[model samples]
Target: MGESLSQRLQHPRRSLGDRHRSQAEKFLRLSNQGEGEFSVNIQWAEQNARQALLHDFTHPENWRMLAKIKVLLADDIGIRALLSDLFAVLGRDPEYVSQLEDVSLLDVGSELLNAALQNDHLDSDIWIQSFDASDVDSFVERFLKLDLSDPRCNVLFGRRLERLWDIAGSDVCIHLGKVLLSHRPQNYEMWTNLGRAHERMGDYDQAWLCYDQAQSYAGHLTVRDDFKERMESHFDGNSSVAWSRPEISVRKDFLVTMEKLSTRFSDSVIDTGASNEEVHVDQSGDERRLENMLKNGDFSSAFFLSRRLVTSGEMWAKEYLEASKLALEGKDDVIIP
Candidate 1:
């Protein structure tokens, strides 16, 4: 019985290894299709690399090959995503960490290192050296210029914007915000962040406009109302050029009053988790809150929370995170379910 069980386990392992190697070879062949020039069909190579990772995520060779291809293709976002995944996997195992030391990254440059470096303390390192760069603007610039029909990719770019905001502050992000808005004018989260960035730079007029646009585009109640309140506080009820619209002021006052009243009744208890079905319902409810966080442009919270859900085997959260990743590569139509 022990021998039979061991053989069954080894059989699956052998099959997975075989599939991973086949896919890796396919990736290499396609990646070098036009070795001396740029005529090679790189898309096919990318697809195979993706397949290789799916078969056996722990394979360092596949990670290195894909990283090289992503660099060659100037797919900075793809490289970061690849490295991030590789580190997430390999960082957990000591043997894999040692193997990572021998990998040779290609010419995609230090931007990859910069990304790893910036988030290194928080996550994986994979023995890759950090790049000497002031910022990840080059990668961001490349990402912004690409098409963004995929909603999940839209969020990943939002992560880039978040990083830009953190490293360079609001001035730099405002411009990138404009570029993103030009493509996705209805992204309320982008509008809110743009408004905040403009506010930080003391560009009140632009800030007011962004805030107003955010309120208009907000599909969620919490975000839309928050924008309204921000506009009021910024203008301070001075109905001059800043307060050209009467309705916005009314909304601000009404929401502020409502908030005050809600706080007064905030001590009220809300029952939860009374039964198995209720516990399941609560989980679903928590997932909805997570969805709202993603929609509200809170990528940091969404990402961390998604990580927890992934460990807990929440299929929906996993799907959402995967869609966001696929969106980074511009490979799918991510509707953000």
Candidate 2:
């Protein structure tokens, strides 16, 4: 009986704490190695870290370490999941989570942003306050990569998008604004951002349409009046739609051909960048001359100006030039303001 009991003790089952500690140590060993095999080490570290959490779901240290690993891997979805777990385990103990300064999980529609301003070490505040135009692409890229399915993540991303729009212009604005609208269709701020994006893209008709949608769902009279003022300011008494080109008559065959060609160009734009496309502009001395020619129905001069811009890699101007050429051909079906 003594020998049997001794043999059983040799292969004793480990407690959850002991198993979690062993996995954590293995993760640390792989993570602390020098940089030569960094990717391989990180992969192993992540596996061990995940195993640690599985063995001891209540361990805050395991959750914190896993979140750090996810952040280093640029695994946005993984980071959010770790954060959710951390937030749950550290409930009412945000300070513990906050001390893990490498990553942050902001509370949606809370005073967290204001609180962050007071905490110099807060990662979100540091990023936002130090933003520069040169860093705009990378800044937007980081957020775009995130899986914002969580409402807290969604609200945080929406705020970042609003700031990004002010600097990066229509492309970022339109992309994020549309995403926010899909999740919160009645959000006045989301509609306002979308309308602003459309307005900047030279699509006034679409802009006004978005603004009208904003007014319909607005909770405050001030919000509706603000949208109305914006719409009124855009037209400035022109009674003209931004999308309409010069009136010209063409044969049915020619119009059909143009439509097919235009469709191809539109499809190319849609295919090239499925989610994060940008608007490229190459402003030059000829911009005013091109505008003047187009306004005066001088397709000859406008064609030359647009051609020069397109050759300089201003692809956004290509559509406008194509429409001008169609107009010069005595008929255009491309513009339907």
State every prediction's TM-score relative to the real structure.
0.34, 0.34
Model 1 RMSD to the real structure? 20.1
Write model 2 residue lDDT over 71-176, tens digit each, in one string.
6676755654454344332222334444545644433211332233233222233446767789877755654444332233343455566766668877766765
Q: List the residue pairs that clash in candidate 2.
A: none
Weakest 10 consecutive residues of candidate 2 by summed lDDT: 265-274
Superposed by TM-score, candidate 2 places the C-alpha of residue 245 at a distance from the truth, in angstroms, of: 18
Give one digit per residue, the lDDT tens place, for model 1 in 198-277. Answer: 66776655666667656644433254456556767767766665643334333333222222222221232222234222
Q: Per-model C-alpha lDDT, please?
A: 0.47, 0.47
Which ranges in model 1 have alpha carbons more than 4 Å from their true place? 1-133, 222-224, 230-242, 245-337
Cα error, candidate 1, residue 250 (Å): 21
User: Model 1: which ten-residue window has the lowest total lDDT?
Assistant: 3-12
